[model samples]
Target: MNKIATIDTRLWQLGIMAILLLLGVLKRDFSLLPSQIALTFISGLLTQTLFIKFLNIKKYSFLSTIITCFGLCLLLRSANLWVHPVVAYLAIASKFTLRPFGKHLFNPANLGVILGISFFPETWITSGQWGADLTTALWLIAAGFFVARNAQRLDITAYFLMCYAGIFIIIRILWYGYPLAVFFHQFQNGALLLFAFFMISDPMTIPHKRIGRFIHAILVAVLAYIWQYWLYWNQGIIWGLFFATFLVPLWNILFLAPAYQWQPLSGDSNV
Candidate 1:
């Protein structure tokens, strides 16, 4: 309820970047650092600036929380200065225009990337998960477990994972001649891991009830699988998340549900 300030949110933003930096270094991919930092900083700035200047939602704490998630993605993946900002702006606009009852109906980041990919053929593709490789994927999975556990969103996470895997397995087995190889390749993707952990589990956009979380996660996973396998959408995870975000608020509205809440992790009250 207080005005968001640089001091209040900066640490979380930095922490996200630090995690990405650590992953990048571990992968020996130093080239990604600048882009990662710039993308994250810019995305956070754009979202915060919009919220402060237009929405007047100046609670520094909430703004910082928003920044932390986006910043972490930047660290995970390098983005081009030219395109990311434009796309990110569209996302912010979507939030302001499409929101219901002062809450965005969809995840802003997902909205940006999915729309950019769908409408602008020229837009390039970049994913934070892809930057970290297998090691990052494992770390992300672990992170997802902890986050899901802390948030009490594990049912959602589990439903998401199972539904996605189920759809993928079915598609691979039926359509692809080389199910063995193609199926194995799916597991190798970093973007999928990232989505499963950080993107979909965002405490802000998802529902809190155990049943709601389960249904929401399952829906996102199913949609993601359909987008990727059946629809041949290149940005599968982005599309899945975008649609999921859009649906969550509506689901809450219709069901009169509460948004999920997580107390800070056991050791980290600061969060």
Candidate 2:
């Protein structure tokens, strides 16, 4: 396979931008395009300089900018809040401020959402938590499966989902009366599916080893469930991802160190 086609780092980004746009359109959050475009340009420029470092046609840059705009639109629409452009600028700026070398500790969008929700209460921002209906839940589940397959992380996803569901179920059985409808509603609500598939699976920030990834993913799931149901934390996914981002990398390093120091077996050589 040609490396360029397969390894064009921008392709996944482009795909994600398109996804964000489609989400915006479906949810009718067209107004956020400008900010999304601006953010996309910054993301592209920084990612290209650090990772791909490739110079493409001018049109590509333009399209990339548009992608950011569309994403911002989706984000703002989803939030259903009225944050100013300055706030958006601050959110994007924080991405760089929070990570000096551009290795973001958490998803920028997740961070921005949480910051907006927590510190900027005056912004009047509400997430399109409204768009989170039964149909969207079904779609999110399908997308989650596909994303997990692409990342070769279906095992992790399964472990995480099972842990989350199991904990919630046990909690209901043991303490709270499990309202079946609300229980299911939680799964189908907000951008939980999006976080599970896309944000949580960011390769740069997640564990690489199979076992490590599984354990890390399970932890994320358990933590997410606790935050959402037990704590009633609104930005539950962000909290989960933020912790997973730091902890999973450490877990991978610790687990892999033992293997790295061990000599390979006579017949079975593996890292």
CA deviation > 4 Å runs, candidate 2: 1-17, 26-104, 115-130, 257-271
TM-score of 2: 0.65
How well does each candidate superpose onto the true structure, as a TM-score?
0.72, 0.65
Local distance difference test, candidate 2:
0.52
lDDT string for model 2 (1-271, tens) is 3443233222444465467556655674454545444554565445533332242312122232233333344454333334534344544444345552333354445555555556664432334443657887786677566445543444665766677777777787546876776668767864666566555654444565777877887777777777866788755556776676667546665666232111111121110
In terms of lDDT, the poorest run of 10 residues in model 1 is: 262-271
**Candidate 1, RMSD to the unseen true structure:** 6.2
lDDT of each: 0.57, 0.52
